[model samples]
Target: METVVMRVEELQLGKIVAEDIFANTQYPIIYKNAKIIHEHFRIFEMFNLKEILIYKEKKLEVLTEKQIEVETTIIKLSNYTSFETDYYDAIAQIKREFGNWQAGAKIDITKVRGMIIPLIEKVLEDRSYIFDLNSYSNAKDYLFHHCIATGLIASIISKKLGHDRGTIIQVAIAGMLADSGMAKVAPRIRDKQSALTEIEFAEVRQHPYYSYLLVKDLPALKEVMKVAIYQHHERLNGSGYPKGEKMSSITNFAQIIAVADVFHAMISERLYRLKQSPFKVIEMIKEEEFGKFDAQVVQALVDIVVDLPIGTKIELSNLELGEVMFINKYAPTRPLVKLINSGDIIDLAANRNFYISRVITKEY
Candidate 1:
């Protein structure tokens, strides 16, 4: 049978696989001759299958000329927009739920799980989504965006840390709800544009305990997750709030959420602070906030960002376009970049001024 190499984003329903697809697993992810369906999109993304060999539709020739054109158009129209569409929808839902929680409603674990599960699944399938999450957020809705992005980042970290599927989902939910207690705080404090007074900051710091209280009674949530939600704000050097607990006292899961939470918050555009590049933020987490986070968790994040393959398109902090040529082993974030305009190779490690601002392409 004849087959065509089609980009995964351009795939539509009912295309038959022409060859087996593998992604570092022992067996093929999708067997040859298998027909594609809606779920296959996530699988394709999960494996980062950019293009696949698929058997061409012989049935198209049997249809009318106009019908054949429509079929081709349909195939062209199908793309990777579903994840973004679902993400915005989830954000809107989270905003509504946060309002409900602020209005004295009970914590809805089931609803919260429903909101993040699909999103988690999608991001897990294609982690590149997590790197671009900050773009989806705005200052006005920073709180809502932070909750969702934190969950997604946590799920990625947990997965990288070798957590099982169930635990990863739980961690993601916990990350999303870690700040849920902020709902209980007065709106004047939660939504304030200016800096908070010591009195108000103290009130804000109580959010962790309040978050724990909100989820403590939920039997569906695991005990570890409850603890993680409560302690996510706690730092490693005994400086964290609600309980100022140090190294050995903190759960590893909580640290995972903590790194994820801080990473998203720092990288995201907030009401008071300008957003920093993800690469720069990762550097700060390692060098500046050294003793505040778990080493393993921070390394996991570094691996996630600096694992950029050679030839990946990136935008530098100076608004220059370049393609990564080499990743410095010791300082992976500062790689060798060949500027697009000058066609000159600039070693970022030597030139400390510019850093990778963001990835421009969808896939590395």
Candidate 2:
């Protein structure tokens, strides 16, 4: 038997494991040679397996030849985005960790810190992968996908704010688990495709409190982190929930997580609604009418992410298409763009009337 190293993301759904996979911890033998499933990736990530051996000999009737060719191309090119891999593996680990927490597994603060710090570093080094992963998240569960995105977005904001690594990691963990309360809600309600009744909506709003209770007594986890998780839903202007605490009353950590959570949630796909484009969401966040988030935190996020999808085509408020040309540091949300039709350069920062409606496509 021959084997090749393949990242879990690179694994084809119909592929077979060429060798046994193992976890370094208590659950050592993950599985023997078997067909792969999406859940397998979560298990692989718990122990941080970068690559697994897969039996490439089996033909995948499920996938078209072109799909297989593209997979092979990605592998052969060695086109690695280490950050992207880290970002995904983080989600996988969260699935396992959160499952444990909900199933009466004690919140092991030391273990969680160990698992999440590396994940934060991956995003701090580069946050573009959050957008990349979100795009690929069409098939991912909203809960898992949004948790990881919140974690990544929070850490990126922390990095932009010049927080020390220790502080940043704390915020990342809080962001990752901020909505753990949602796990306690009935799946039927949580997964509902239509608007919830007022009673149902009230239940939905209790999630922050549930998350708070879950981690409140973990001796190893900082009190600050617990507070952040509890208050992540609160707003600066006191419009948010659980407890409508005002801006000055909220901790800075909680404030940062709040901003990240909303941004990631809106940009991510949900069963009930289509996901908003990154540009459009960011624009909404920056507008005066939606000015509930911490101004500094929002700008920090804007500074880090605005010019991120460079070279992507964007639609304007008036529906004209233009290619993003350059970023103006003064106006991170708007960039220098050239009209697709006229080839004329427009500085979006200079023209307040013109703003990106939505990003058409990312360069990657």
Candidate 3:
């Protein structure tokens, strides 16, 4: 029988695989001639497999009609909401849920999945949304916004790290809920505008444990996800809270959320602290905070920020406008830039006093 290459998104139910599919495992993930089932979609996404060979159906007439429907879903971009709208709406939902949690309500996992899954899908569609997460945040709604953005950031980082779609979504959820335990803390402590007292700080640090309690009984959540929620605050160097877990004890999933949580928290504005530039914050995470995080997870975030295309407009720490002219392989963050006003090319690697403050425009 003749076979045709099909995009994984276009593959219909019951289609026969034309060849074995391997995702670097010792054995094939999907055997040749096996029928495609609903579960296989996740396997394909997990492996990031774009296209696969499938035997042509005996009835070409029915196949064409089915393929058209699949193609329509694939090509349609209008179905999704704008990233910002979906994002803020999710924040609002999380705010409500946090209130519910404070009122002694049980977690409604279905509702969380509904609000977050779309935001994740939209963000995954346009990876640039990750860059602007900090700008969308405010001090008043910082906690709510952080939860949603952390989930989105975690999802993208997980994707970059080559995790399956399901696992990526789980990591996003875990990252968002990592701080949910704060709802269990005293309101005065959580809402305090000034510095937290050492006693208050100690109580606040138990949020991760509270978070684990909130979701421990959830059957929909995997056991590893529950552990990640509890361990998101746990650092690789054993400096983190709840439990002082070292490198060997921490799970990769927890580390993904940990990096995402810190990245969003530092770049975002809060009552007690000023928001730092994303570029500057990333530098601190990679250098100053090096030993506390997983190297692979930190590198994934670095690649997302530093691997910018030339001609991307940006602002420097000195309030000067410029566009990226070239990227230095060694110091990806410190690229050569052309000053928008002065028309002079300065290599940021050599110019230690200046650094990227924010990306103005991504388009060339």
Cα error, residue 343 of model 2, in Å, equals 4.4
Worst window of 10 by summed lDDT in candidate 2: 71-80
Candidate 3: misplaced stretches above 4 Å?
1-81, 362-364
lDDT of 2 by residue, 199-299 (tens): 99999999999888878887666898899899888888898888899868888899899888888777777776777667667877888426588788888
Q: For model 1, how does the per-residue alpha-carbon lDDT over 211-293 read when each residue is reduced to its tens digit? A: 89889999988999999999998888999988999998999999999999999999988888888889999999999999999
TM-score for each model: 0.78, 0.68, 0.77
lDDT of each: 0.84, 0.71, 0.83
> Residue 68's C-alpha lDDT in candidate 2?
47
- Which pairs of residues clash in candidate 2, taking residues 3 or more apart in a chain or in different chains? none
Candidate 2 RMSD computed on C-alpha atoms after optimal superposition onto the true structure = 19.0
How many residue pairs clash in all the candidates, one count each? 1, 0, 0
- What would you estimate as the lDDT of candidate 1? 0.84
Q: For model 3, what is the error of residue 168's alpha carbon versus the real structure, in angstroms, after optimal superposition?
A: 0.8
Residue 51 error, candidate 2, Å: 52
Local lDDT at 212 for model 1: 91
TM-score of 1: 0.78
Instruction: Please identify model 2 stretches exceeding 4 Å from their true place.
Output: 1-80, 307-323, 329-331, 339-344, 349-364
